[model samples]
Target: MTDTATDRSTDPQKAPSTPPQGGQGVMARIRSYTPTLRVQRVLAMLLLIAQGGITVTGSIVRVTGSGLGCNTWPNCHDGSLVPVAGAAPMIQQIIEFGNRLLTFVVAAAALLVFIAMVKAGRRAELKTLAFVSGIGVIVQAVIGGMSVLLDLQWWAVAIHFLPSMILVWIAAILYTRIAQPDDGTATRQFPDLIRILAFVAAVCLAAVLVTGTMVTGSGPHSGDAGVGMEGRLEVDTRIMTYIHAAAMYIYLGFTLVVAFLLHRVKAGDAAKRTAWVLLAMIVVQWAIGLTQFYLGVPRWTVPAHIAMSSVVVAFSAFLYAHGRVREGGTGTSPTGSPVGDARLAASRA
Candidate 1:
């Protein structure tokens, strides 16, 4: 006999199974889980920190002369995912392999931030920033693998490092944007002249970084001991160092000008504070650069320099972001009216 509805409900074997929500299963669940703004901001902040942190680890691999510790790309010691016995010095293998492993950690952080942005229904700008960050991590990994396959060529290594800075820039912007309300209007915190100066400062910073890479390519650290001077850039280290130093001075000057303008314009306290912090970091970075020059680039200074570069980049991005803010519903209107009060008066009228 056919099972009746009551019998089916009572019989375990005959009971009708409930289909997954909307029949979309995991994807539906993922779509349903919305992250709070605070959670999203935390994820973004973590991504920013991870982007900066990996550069330090990469510097460790370079300074340790362990770039080719595993001696292969997409595998450690060839035909293996981890370090192989006697493939290289155990420490070198571990260092290089460990650095490679960190790529995943950074990528995981990027993924989490990306998911947070999407789940929170954040604005397009935030979404794009998160998306680019994830993509940037993958690009960095590919470039890293290519650098390994190319035997850690100077240019290849530079190519690998620069994207990381770009990713850091993106992550910084993402962190800044995540804190802004989705429904908000753009508010300029400073005058257009100051904004232009900030733009020039950013350009100078880019030059400083690019020239700095050139200096590195001409330096003693070729990422691997075996690489030596074979594939190193042919430029004279002294001349490249001078050029890098010049670019840095110009960047520092422009940053100082920006800070001056911020004070002159009586900008928001946050903008002024960011400008001050950026100025301080630039000074510290300049001192580190001088120490590297005078001390002949000590091994310990490489990572310190690299870490400070990341910090400087993040703060530079932050200072620029502070130039423009998104004014939310509760924020002041461009005409100096209280946003909520203006709406209230309009409604009353």
Candidate 2:
């Protein structure tokens, strides 16, 4: 009669109870509450991907300078959520409002993931992450609205971008954790030195992203030209750009150093491979950053830069994750090579 039962982790040894043959009510109710791990995992991944993808679209809105196309929050213009045709060009409305509409997609993904976690009796860690994701979307929506209300001020736009980066990072963590069993034991793959390097790499990446936002705020694209550019960051765009680039250099430097340490320590091939991918993403992102700057922050490159930013952050997070435990293959090569399992078994023996 009560749906409020919380402890739902299925017992491996419990025999299935047979319901009355003619009336299957009890069995039907029991079946409804069982959580399928596969479905929950898939939903978690989609939420992670969507979190990053929406950030890219948001950049489009800014680079194209349609940030205020709808000119108001909660409602598009004055009285309605939909855009008023006479208030702005149809394309502008579509671009800005489209970004807003996608917010719903983010909300839906986060909601579904949270529901899946609770219903499946996932670990408290996973449930908390999913719940945070849903809450984050709400907070993001409010910040987005504030940006519009404030006329897309440089600071507002910058604030808006920062959270997307954070959510992407969290989503990556969630994706990584979902692969593990609900049992809360920790198994580390990389040694201490490598772990320190990975942590440094992550810290540097955060600096790089913060500086990158400053660079964006000082750059030509104001998200909306109508918004007074007077409020833009006082720092010279060139100087901020250089600072951003320097932070990026540090991030890449640390990541490469980690890769080197991975090799020096003769770590597992999976760890080495993940380190390589992380380094590659950092280098490619740096290239895009340089290109965007030299090309005068062209519109097309803005989205590219944003997209790569997301990719680099996600990759760095995943690398850090692999350092903790082998993703999906617990104690096995992330690349699914049998050697990882062999090594793990050997170590245990």
Candidate 3:
């Protein structure tokens, strides 16, 4: 006879068998774990911070002339994932190897945010951004390895920095995107003038960054002291610096004009606020650049300047994003209603 409810507990057959290792049960359990939007928001923030932060650490390695500390790619030293006991100065090895290790921290953070986005069934937009961020970390790692293999060539170093700026831009986009209500649609808040100026500002910012890297390539700091200045860009440091400064001045002018337009159109407070923040960042970054120059580009200023560059890029991206469709309105609307009442519920988290 079949077991009755009363007999179920007493019957060995009624007991669940041990789940198969790495079977459906395990996957089901994993799938059942969903993260709250608040938790996801925090994780997104961490990913954003890490993407920018790692650049600072990279600058540290460069400024300290430890770019080739391990002297190998995909390894700290031959056949080792970390610094070897007697290979090179311990300080150089430690700094270079430690910076490499940070890639894992960034990867882990991005993975967490990606998994959370998927588990929560977030919109495709959010998932796509998270996915790009996850992949960006891998791409950055590969480029870093390439930099090591290329002997820290100035152009290679510049290439490495470019991708990171792109990744930081992407991360900033993800941060703002995720800040919206979990299930809400999105729409634009600014008028056409604001959007157009924002685009111009972004273009100017890109120019500024590109020229800034060129200025770096011609400067004394060649990533590693031993890398030598043989392959450094042939451009005069003074000329490149002046060009970079000019580009920055133009960028500042565009940003200020955009800020004025943001107010002229009477855009949302969020848009206005972002404009002001971008302006502030621009001023601060400009000051840092000038100070670092006259003060003779101290090693300490390298990290600070690099860090501010990341901030400037992030905010430039942010201002551009604010001009686009915002957190909530028509989720599928490409050109969302500018005056739509929909707004992100991100403040809840």
Candidate 4:
């Protein structure tokens, strides 16, 4: 037996004296840096950043009147992969090319997220999020192409902006979900007043988005002269725009109230952080809106206004995700379904 042991020890490829269980072997070698739930969260956050970048770039294209620079969808001018050689001007080419490059980047990021989700295996919710984001990226690309092909019609532009905002929100929710481990208990709870404030804030944000679309549609920046029949702002348009602006002030007030409530309840660090972010975003957004209007819609201000709206939307989504019923129920998910209710109840107790 001693001689045999010596012979076995001489073979480098031979199994060790005690082989590990399959699961143990896998677990033992699992490095911390290996793809994990955290990686998925990071990827989701990156994808959101990319989405936000695309929105900003698209705004640049609009503000610069570069929407028509390429003059076609899925291709630049003259049917070339790059912009037309010396076509028009270099600035036009740069802006249009930059926008196109961003689209490709977003698509690539989405694909990476999909792969990460698949590798995550047992995380169903995360996998679903990745799937939704991937689908959203594809649909967004198609709609973007349609916008270009249709010469950036007002409705197309509105839908494009809206869906991208929604995608960002989805990404934000996924990030929060994955970043926090699902302890058997859920700690999300808030008073009735806080719930009402969150609801009002969300409604106000949506109203702001819709009305901003109308305002853009009515403005020269929309790139579509056909929006408002006969170039006249309809009563509906006026009403929506006013409501949208009014909603902004309402949102600002509600957010302040939320900040106060958050302070009163001593909500956890997460909720408090969210409240602060919401407050900052609300203040900045209001200031930007005023500046944009007073500045008479300057090209630079247009993108600023748009960027602020995106921030507000993201914050609103964060608030909604973190909101839990005080009676120990999970707040409604984006699709209006309850999640983590049982866990929340246990935590409340």
Candidate 5:
């Protein structure tokens, strides 16, 4: 028996102990709650949908002459929390009220995105995007109020439209960053042709938006005298409409070209898919634009056109962001490096 019964010291050859099952379970719970790149991407998409809905509803408010239904910011007529008895009846009040409710929803969505960004600790790029989207909602709300207060002045309305487009772009970036494959083979070097194509597409998009604003300002939707004050298309309005149509055609061409190049480069499945989506949106948008023009801006077509434009801008921006990232780079990491090529290679191995 010797000293064995009294020996309390541990042996040098003792194997190391692993963490307990309960400890591992806690770690798994922590990971589940942590915001990941995929979660951020999903949040961004949700925010985009909200923004698009808001844009469409806002257009409905204008197109239906419901903009003035409330007659005040943050309140209805007579300072009542709800629409008064004489205040444009129930249907008008409901539509206008619904539009107001959406603004709050959009704001709430943006706040959630901001919180998620903080949780995704390592993805600085996504964090910045969420911050921008959050700030954009606030600015958009302010601009929107001003539009109503100013009687929907053309410039104020146009400014309000611009932010929605920016929000769409931010969402697209978030989408691309998360969806990009982690393979090390993505080329960092962008072809000059691709860069040129992106630049042209961006220019075309801006022109289309500006011309659209002009067209709206000139049309009945602007709450102004439509087309002519005296039986002829007002010189100013006519010119603007032509410019808008021209810009639409140019945008259509640019989008098709981008789709062609994207296919030519074989720029991964994600990029190709995005390009195709953009092309489809472009086609649909053109059809709506034409229909709106020929139909003299039918009530239904107005919101439809606005909604389609939102989608087109979002998809186009996705294509642009996907193209900008060096072929293999994740764009999610702090350094924008091709995140851990060795890990990807090891996974393949």
Candidate 6:
């Protein structure tokens, strides 16, 4: 009690510590630095692109018969983490291993954007989207390994591909949400009727994707040249193609209806623009599908077709998300009134 506290304050070893000039700690620094809207949007966009790009690379591994190039999961071969001489063809090993490596890249991008969202104190919806997207990358990696372990069976391969589309959709929505402020009220940009129509269109797109995968499963490419037609789906390729094409037409019809309604309504510019871009993507995909059907599904068209699939999914998600948006205005309540005004009124009541 005799000035002990004062002595402790003066003694460096006994004194309470102060944070460094920059920040208290690494996490504190990260939490203190809020990312700009532009930076956050860019990170979201990168995640979206990575989600889409990885699918195309996976297609490359399939079309080149390199699906089994590694011949194992979590490792290049039985013992090596990388390519080894006389293990597999150099090109196949490189293609398969490289595709696996890209999974990490996609995961890393998702993690960065997610961390940015958390640091920026984004809304729960945005954070959830980022979390799901990051988780999806890990799930996809596991599925990919399963496909290899199962000798690249048609169903396993199809399973691996479908989740990528879902991740793309999630990333697209995240990109849209990152532009909004955390405290803003959610507003509908279009009528509920139109939103319902968009939902139906999205469902049709999913059907198209599933049927298309079935077509590939039944077609010439069985991922591994050595597997040949043994593990392929037993369905006739022509029948599967017909089913896939029919699903595409239905999807196209529903999308056209959504586009028409979007134009009729005074939807936001972003919504209308996304609708048009989606239409264009659907048409391009149609052309590619036709080319693949007539040309016996060439190797080159597979990647193009897969890439366009990602684009279509992204734009479709963008259009749907435009139906409802966070107003990004100050102190707005869910009813579109100022939060302060509402609070004052409540106080008066």
Full-model lDDT for every candidate: 0.85, 0.80, 0.82, 0.70, 0.71, 0.88
- lDDT of candidate 3 over 118-229, digit per residue (tens): 7666677888998998898999899899989889888889988888888899889887776565445457778777778778878888899899889888888887878779
lDDT minimum window of 10 residues, candidate 3: 334-343
TM-score of 2: 0.83
Q: Write model 1 residue lDDT over 93-168, tens digit each, in one string.
A: 9999998889899999989987776655566788788889989999899899999999988999999988899899
Better of 3 and 6 by lDDT: 6
What is the Cα-based lDDT of residue 288 in candidate 4? Answer: 78
**TM-score of every prediction relative to native:** 0.87, 0.83, 0.86, 0.76, 0.77, 0.87
Ranking by TM-score: 6, 1, 3, 2, 5, 4
**C-alpha positional error of residue 314 in candidate 2 after TM-score superposition, expressed in Å:** 0.7
The collision pairs in model 1 are none
- Badly placed stretches (over 4 Å) of model 3 are 1-30, 326-349
The candidate that achieves the highest lDDT relative to the unseen native structure: 6
Which ten-residue region of model 6 has the weakest summed lDDT?
Answer: 332-341
Q: Which structure among the candidates has the greatest TM-score? A: 6
Model 6: colliding residue pairs: none
Say which prediction, candidate 2 or candidate 6, comes out ahead on lDDT.
6
Total clashes for model 3: 4
Which residue pairs collide in model 4, if any? none
RMSD of each: 7.3, 9.5, 6.0, 7.8, 7.0, 6.3
Q: Mind giving the per-residue lDDT tens digits that candidate 4 earns over 1-349? A: 3577776789866636674679886775442113455566677788878877788888888777676677677777756867775665667677877888888788888877777655443246767877898889889878887887877777777888888888888877776665544332455567778878888877777777877887876666754222224332344544555677897888788878887888899876777788888888888877877776667678888777777777777777777777742222233322111333332343345
- Runs in model 4 deviating more than 4 A are 1-33, 223-241, 324-349
Off by over 4 Å in 1: 1-31, 330-349
- How many steric overlaps are in each model, in order? 0, 0, 4, 0, 3, 0
Candidate 6, overall lDDT? 0.88
